[model samples]
Each structure stands twice: as C-alpha cells, then as structure tokens.
Target: MDRRVLFATLILLAGGATGVGVALFAFVGVDDATTETTVVWESEPAAGDDGSGAAVATVDGDPLLLRPAVENGSRVVRATVAGGDETTWTVPISGPDAERGGGDANGSDGDPSGVSGLTTGTLGGDPVAALTTAPGELVVVDAADGTERFAVDIGGPGGLRPAIGDLTGDGTPEVAAVGTDGSVRVVDGEGDSVTEASLSGDIDRRPLVVEPDAEAGERGGIAVMTTTGDPATVHLLDETGEARWTTTPNVNPYSWNAADSRDGSVLVLGGTSGNIEAVETGDGSDRYEVGLQDLPVEVGDADPGTVYVGGSGSVWAVDLLDGEVVWKQQYGASTRINEPGVGDTDGDGELAPVVVNRAGEVLAMTQRGKVTARGGPDAVVYGGPLFADVTGDGGDEVIVVADDGTAIAADT
Candidate 1:
C-alpha cells in the first residue's frame, strides 16, 4: 500500500486520535524498521529569544538562522549556523537609554516594547535585516556582522511586521512597513523613502510585497489589509505607493497575511470569518472563496495549485482555483496550530508542510495531508517553524524556537 494511504488507514483505525503520539505512530508505524527523526543540533536559550518568528539568510555562502530577541532592555538579533557559529547585534532603538516607555533599563521584565520580528532584506546589495526598533524608527543592519547600515524614522508606530521586496524595479530589495496611522511606507535598500501611501483604516499585519511578472506586463505591488473594519479592505498599491485597486473580500479584518499565488496572479488570505479568499492581483476581484468549520489563524505555504492553512486545531490543503478543499486534518480540540513551513523535508523530491502547535508538537505532513514525521523540543512554542539547509547537507531541516528560547534543528 502507498505510505499516505496506509497512514490514513492507521489514523482512522486509531479513532482519529490527535497529538504527537498519533503522529509518531503514523510516521514510524508499528514496525521497528520505520524511520525516526534525528536531532541535528540544539542551541542553548537564545538570549531573550522572543519566540515570534525567525528568518534565514545566506551569509558568506553559509545559511544563517536569524532569531529575534530582547537583551538587556535592547532589541537584538542573533544569527547562528548549524555548526554553532553565532553572532549578536544590538539594535539601537530611539529612546532614553535604549528602553521603551520608561521601562527598566535591564529589560529584566522581558518587555519587547519597541521591537518587532526580524525580517531579512538587503542594504547596498549586502544582505541585511530590517528591524523595527520603535514605532517610528526602522534600522537596517548587516546580516553577517553587527554593523549598522542605515536607520530611518517611518513617522508612525509600525504596528505589524514589515516585508521586503524589489519595489523600485531597481533590482535592490525594498522594505514595506505598515504604520498604526493607516499608512504604508516603502524604503529602498539605501534607507531612503521610495514612496508612501495612506489607507482608510489601520493594518494588523505587515504589507505583502508582491513580485512583478515580466511576461504578463504586470508590475508587482504591495497588498495591504485593514484590520479596523468589517469585510476587510484589500488594497493593491503600485511601486509608487499609488492604489492600483482596492476591494473588500468577505474576510475579517484581522485575517492572516495574504499570500501570492504560485504565478503571482492572485493573493490568497484566510480570515476569522471562516472564509479562504483568493483575489485577482490586478483588479482586486474575487477569484474564489471557500468556507471552513473554524476560523483560520495562519496561511501557510502556497504551492502551484494548492495552499495550506491552519485554523483552530485543524490544517487544510485547499485548491486555489475553485476554493475546493483537497484535504483536512483535525489536531483535536486543544491544539492551536501555527504557520507551517513547506519543503522537501524527507529528501523525497516532494514537498511537505511541517507545523508546530502551541504545545510544541512538530508534525510534518505529506502533500496529501498524511502525517509523515513528528518531532518537538518538548516545550511550549509560540512562533512558527522555519525550514532551511542549515547543515549544508543538501536537505532542509526543521528549525523551531521553543517558548523558553531554545532553538532546535531536526532531520526527518
């Protein structure tokens, strides 16, 4: 029997049990010959690891995992490799003594007041990280070293995270950040303002930077969604920060970030309204809308024809064209699934979606929704998992940060 089919049969035989145990049994089977996950390496508590999310970038031809944290009342980013070479950079936020809102200078209270999640971009053709040190301040630093490249005051509190893309058609990446004042600012690689635009409502998530399609005569733009209104507004902005089109899908304002379609023709988003929506990239027209049993919290990896979504204790693979659900798996009532990382985790030439829930259960499922591998740090997990070739083994490994700040890499 096919492995996916056999795994599905075992799941049904177990009365649809959910949790790490079920995933392990399904992955390893009742036979001892089945494969098991191996820990590649584990790092000590990344100093003040915020457990928000992480980004991977190539430094000196080596893959480095960048983890965000707060250290000694300062916003800092730490980079590490599979072999344990590490570097730390303290981001200088604009405040009195590097503290926000008159907080303790030592940051002993674990306050990440002014810092947002670390996002990898580029500055002057060198790989850099865009760190929001405060609401109005954005800083770019070299990813390989702790050197500051440039810093700019964005003029408002950056409420959500920022995204990086080439907005100026100049080949260098730009940073798109949404401010609490209902504005979007585009900054070039040199820390200069490329363009800025205003919206009618506040944004709850980072602006999505869409790439241009040369063959389609489509200049890529940014997709921003408002979180303050019903039937959330989706706006498509040109490179100059001009609105190309704006439409409100039947989605809640605080939905997961929109994802670009495989061909960059549509943007997919999942909302608390229990609707997964796909909108045309050019005209902001509705392409499809599908309903689900629970509210979706995260929109995961988007393949050519399908997209993965994680909702209240459930993960779903949905067809992009007609809003059809290819498959769905429920992880019981207690699990709160995070965003999933998609990759060829098992060296099988086929991509799989790997997810870690709040309870720190790492589960990797095949494209057909069969649970193939399971591993975890055995601690609470707040951030989502990331996949990268950290070991230089020509295969991707699952990298996750536990709530206690431990970073673990596992091979499936």
Candidate 2:
C-alpha cells in the first residue's frame, strides 16, 4: 500500500477509538508516515466573529490562552485555559456609542475592527494584554479578569504593533509603538509617553526592542523599518530615543516584522523582496542577503543559528551567519503559511518547528525540515499558531484560531 494511504488509515483507526475523525488529505503524497495526534480541546466560535490569533498569558499563576477578536459588533479579548475556564473582556475601541462593525450586529456600517497584534506583557508588575486594534488604538486589559487597564491612541491609521521592553533601564517593561508618521512612542505603565523618537518615512510594523548585552559590549536599541518605498530604510534608536545608525536594505514595504538574531548581533528581515537580509546590529550595516521565492509573511528564529521564513506554500530554514538555506519544506501551491512556532510538540525532548496553513493544516517538522507530525483544526485558519503548556503537562500545545473564531489546541 502507498505510504500516504497507510498513514491515513492508521490515523482513522486511532481517531475512531477516540470518537474523532482524522483526515490526512493534505499530506497525500508526502513520504513520511503521519504521527498520531489528538485534539486536546476546542472552543466554540464567537458570535459575529471573523477570526483571531492566540497568545499565551499567565493569569494568577495559571497559563491562559488569549484570543483577541471583534465579536458581535464589539472589540473584545477572550481568555481560556485547558480546563475550560474562559473570560471575555469587551474593549472600548472607540467609545460605547461609537459605531462598531462585525458579526450580525445591527446599526453598524463600518468594517470590523482588525486585530493587528495580540501580545502579553507586564504593566507595573501585573500581567496585561496589549491588543492593537485597527484605525489606531492600543487597549491594555488585565489578563486575569478582562478588566480594562488602560487604552492609548497609537497614532496612525493602524496596522502597527507594540513591543514591550525596558526603555529606561529601570527593570520595568515599557510599551513601544510606531505611528504611521514614523514616530516611535515609548509608553509606560500609566499610559504616559516615556520617550518619543522619529524615523524618516512612514512606518507600519512593530518596533523591535533590542536589549543591552554587557558581555558583547552592545548597547540595546529600538529598531524600526520604513515601509513607504523600495530599498526601505532601517533605523536603530538608542535608549534615549536618539537615532544611532540607519541603513537601507533592498527590501520593500510588503514585508513581515524583522527579528533579531540569537546573539542580538544581527537583525534578520524578509518579505516580498524575495530575499532575507541580515543587518549588523552594532552599526546598522548589511551582513548578508539570501534569495528566496514566494512572498514571506513572517520570519522567526528557529535554533541558535537558523531562522525560519514562512511564505506562500513553503517554509525555509536559513543559516543566520552564512545566509545559506539549511532546509526548505514545500506545501504545494495555494497554501498560505503563517509564522511557525517552535517547541517540543511531541514531548520527545527535541524541539520542532510547527506551521499552520490557511487551509487549517498543521505540520510539525524536524530541525532538518522533515515533517514529524501532521494535525490541524480542520477549518480555515487566519491567524498564526501559538505554543504553550495549556494543559499544565509541561509539554507545549499548538493553539490556532479558525476563521469562524474557534480556537483549537492539538497535541501530537
């Protein structure tokens, strides 16, 4: 029998015993046998919802899955745990009486508010959810109870995300947001602007906060990329909101957010430019550029020396130092892959990079780019995947949200 057919048959058999259905059509021609997977839990879709991405947060010493969505004509953040405890916090994106759009809500003509980013961080030593809403707003809520901690205008039409770091070297994390006007605003726990700096050209991506390295003699800084034109410029700002150095890379506006190399010595950037460029963090100089196909939607650090680039239908693991492609996995045409999350999803004491496509197919690949496991929500997925030990089993669970707003956690 064909290997693919045999793998599917085995999955069906295993799933049958659990009253679950396993379909491996997405890996029909793949050579490796699929690993057994179980759906740990599934949350119902929110009413009048489009989609959401999952972020893990610690609430009262417990890990919770945070899903930010525009549901039922309101912008809200939903928190859930593996044991099924859930809380929904309605965010006042505009105002209570302001027109909201989404789901089946009446009296709304505006488009549904887009969740540009969802991240968890500390605000004055308390856990908080920083949610960026479309059209320009950053709403911070208490992670434990969904209470509105604070909200600040991010200044722009939207699409910019926030980064959390210590801008004052005070041991407390501050929020950094880039306005469309090219200004980076560092806000404190009280929602006050700690410092504001400007970059040339308009900015749309999240600002990267680089921490100081004492041993490397590297002073930490904030990095922002310009998205107004080709050959985009990258600016590195100091702790005092001053520009240190700026370099232009052969990149375009249609790029994902840049990521810092493991040692914080190089910044890796990828996008529609069809290449990954590594910029030296010390002086903002180009280190190396590796060509790639397909437009990259996200870039993430895989291991110490390798970074994974996720694009349409494929993911590439490239060596950071030499710009060499270590391994590349292709998922065929018409598949849109989100940024992959790395963890030991199989609890084998070895880390693997897991990716989810728009078709809702989840694939966990070995460090060498071989598919080690295959599972999914079996629904259309619009958000990137998040890894966390939601089951408190000390093993990470891959969580993804479907287009209908259902959040699914699967264990392999």
Candidate 3:
C-alpha cells in the first residue's frame, strides 16, 4: 500500500481503528499501543440514477470520505453516501488531557471526555486523522475508529491545522504544519520531529502539496504561501522542509488554490485577482497566466487536461496547455459560490463541476457550466463541498456542516 490514497488507482481499506459490523477499521489510544481495523464494503459501479457511475471520483473501488462534525463538545466523523437511501456512520474523537493528551477514540468503552474531532488524512496507507488533542499538541487518530496512533507537540496558539502527505516517497506520509511563528514543522509517524523549515514572515494560508511534475509521485514538495512579505512569497519546499523554489505570486491575494498544470509539469495557482498563473516547478520561473473573474476561490482538475476554477458566481473550465477559458458559466449576483468538488453529477462519462457557497447552496453543473441538479442551503458552507461514497451504496454525496454544528449529506 502507498502512503497516499490511490485516488489514481484503487481505494485500499487495509488499516484503521478496531471495530466490528458492516466492515470497519479502527484503532486504540496511543497509550494503549493497540493497532487494528475492520472494514466491510462491496465495490460496485459509482452511484447515479442509472447506476452508470458515481458523482464523485473513485479509485478502483469506492472509499468513504470523512467529515469532522462537532456537536456540543463532542466531535465525530460523519461518513455518508448519497443516492437512493443514504447511509451514515460516526466515530468519536478524544479531547483535552491534564498531564499529557491521551484517550481511546472509542470513548469510555465508546465515549470520550472531549468535544473536538480529527482532521482526515492518510496514515500508513489507511484513513487517519490529525487531531488537536490539546492547545499545543497534535495527535494522529485512525479514521476507522478514532484511536490515537501517536501524539506530537506542535507549538501553536493560533490553532492552525497541519497537512499530511508522503513527503519522502517512502510509502509513509509525514504531518506538516505551519506554526504561528511562520515556520513549517514536519513530524514522522512515531510522534518525532523530522524538520522545521522557516522561510516566510507571516504565514496566513494553509500549506498545499504539489509535485511540480505529477509523475514525481510522493517525491513532490509542499507549497506554503505567506500573507506578509516584501513581495508576498510562496515557498515550494522539498521533502526535508527545505525551500526548493520561491515565487512572488501576488500582493493582495484574497484566496488561492493550487492544482497541476494540464501536462502535469508545472503548478497552476488560481487567485481571487482573476488571474491563473502556471509556475515552473524546477526554478519557480513564469510559465503562463489566464485571467478569469468573480474571484476564482477554488481550483482543481477532475480530468487530466482540464482545470476547473469556481467562485461565488462563476465557474470556468480552462485548457491546460494554452491557458484558455474553454468553457464558463455565471450564476447570479445573489448567488455566493466558493470552491468546487468534482463528480459525474448527471451520469456523464466525464466529471462535472460541483460547488457550494457560504449560504449552503449546492449545485451540480454540467461540463458546459449549466445546472444539472440543484440541492440545499443544507449547511452554512464556507468552503467547497466534500464528495464521497460512505454507504457502500455506490453513488456520491455532498457533505456539509452548518455554522450551528448541523452536519448534513445532500445528494449530488
């Protein structure tokens, strides 16, 4: 099994927390030193009306997408699949501790003492999470059952979360977090510090993983953007937290998302300035730029050669080779769209654009940028909607959490 989810190949359910029934993989607390997982699922075609394919992307088989939902003081992973009748599951997370942060994800025989949940990621080739067990501590929790695998202290009062990936191409991913001090910290599996690279002045955005060349596999680097600098720098760091290249993207970037260029050789970043720039991965040289409007908040690739960028009122399909706006659509001034998730919403052989806004609006748009299926004000969405198939039912669904802690799964 590889460190990253084989989204390009197959979804492997090999490791997780210990649990039973309906096929699950779970884990125990770090203090308990127990590792196990139980999973039960049957692979079928992706879900849709005709059951032709799924609305969301998949590997060889269907894999559940984990969403952290908080209620009162308790947080759980809400796994859902949309189509026909919906299926859902929950895994409890551990909370704060006195001396050192520690607790079983199954709680007190299935309940915990805390209110927070884990951020989903891949650990040891299975679904896992990076959780903030304490104010200055980060813990790795198995997504299968919320068991703490290991805990590492990441000094932070600003509460910025960490990103995990196979930074070393060793089939074992590392946890990387940008501390409040504008430094990026790397932690290995056993809760040990691997590297701490400080390059920018005031880091404001999250760190994204980019492989300069998509074929680079786990050999790629992390992209960290800074809010305040002489020229607003974006540092591309190698596996050891070393800066491989740095570029000044913009002065006042409202929002930006990174995706692979069409040919998989460069990094294409879409910013709110309505500018999409492709930068060389080797030396941070200028490649090309495309201009689009409505503040392109989220950018991604569902196909190998096309990049989809969406905002509050518009979505554009850009050609990877020449940076041309191949297709586009606009909603309305009253509509607020942000990021996009890819799915075969209308059972099209190719993937389409799916987006949500702060108002909880969910829309599945066709390849030509027309609304196919419209649903929700389901959750007060501040970001792009997440797509997954949790029910083993085949079809893909949209997962959203409201401002009031309401978690809902809507059909795509």
- The prediction achieving the highest TM-score against the true structure is 1
Stretches of candidate 3 above 4 Å error? 1-119, 131-134, 212-219, 294-296, 300-302, 344-350, 368-370, 390-393
Q: Please, what are the lDDT tens digits per residue for candidate 1 over residues 1-412?
A: 4433333322222112221012111222222232455678787676554565457777777777777665676656677774474554444444432323322111112334456667886667788877664456677778877577777776676625678887656677888877666777888877788888888876656678887777777778898887544566788899888999888776663344445554456787766645567788878887766665445456767767878877677777776666666677665355777766688786667778887777767777777776766656676776677777767777788887776567788777
What CA RMSD would you report for each candidate? 6.7, 9.4, 16.0
TM-score of 2: 0.81
Ranking by lDDT: 1, 2, 3
- Write one digit per residue (lDDT tens) for candidate 2, span 223-292: 8887544567888888778888887775553444444455566777775645667788889887666656
Candidates sorted by TM-score, best first: 1, 2, 3
For all candidates in order, the CA lDDT equals 0.66, 0.65, 0.51
TM-score of 3: 0.69
The reply for model 1, stretches above 4 Å from the true place, is 1-35, 47-49, 83-85, 88-112, 168-170, 258-264, 347-350
Q: Write the per-residue lDDT of candidate 3 for residues 205-228, one digit (tens) a residue.
A: 556665333365424777777755
What C-alpha lDDT does candidate 1 achieve relative to the native structure? 0.66
Candidate 2 off by > 4 Å = 1-30, 47-53, 83-85, 88-92, 95-115, 168-170, 257-263, 332-334, 347-351
| Model 2 C-alpha lDDT versus the unseen true structure | 0.65
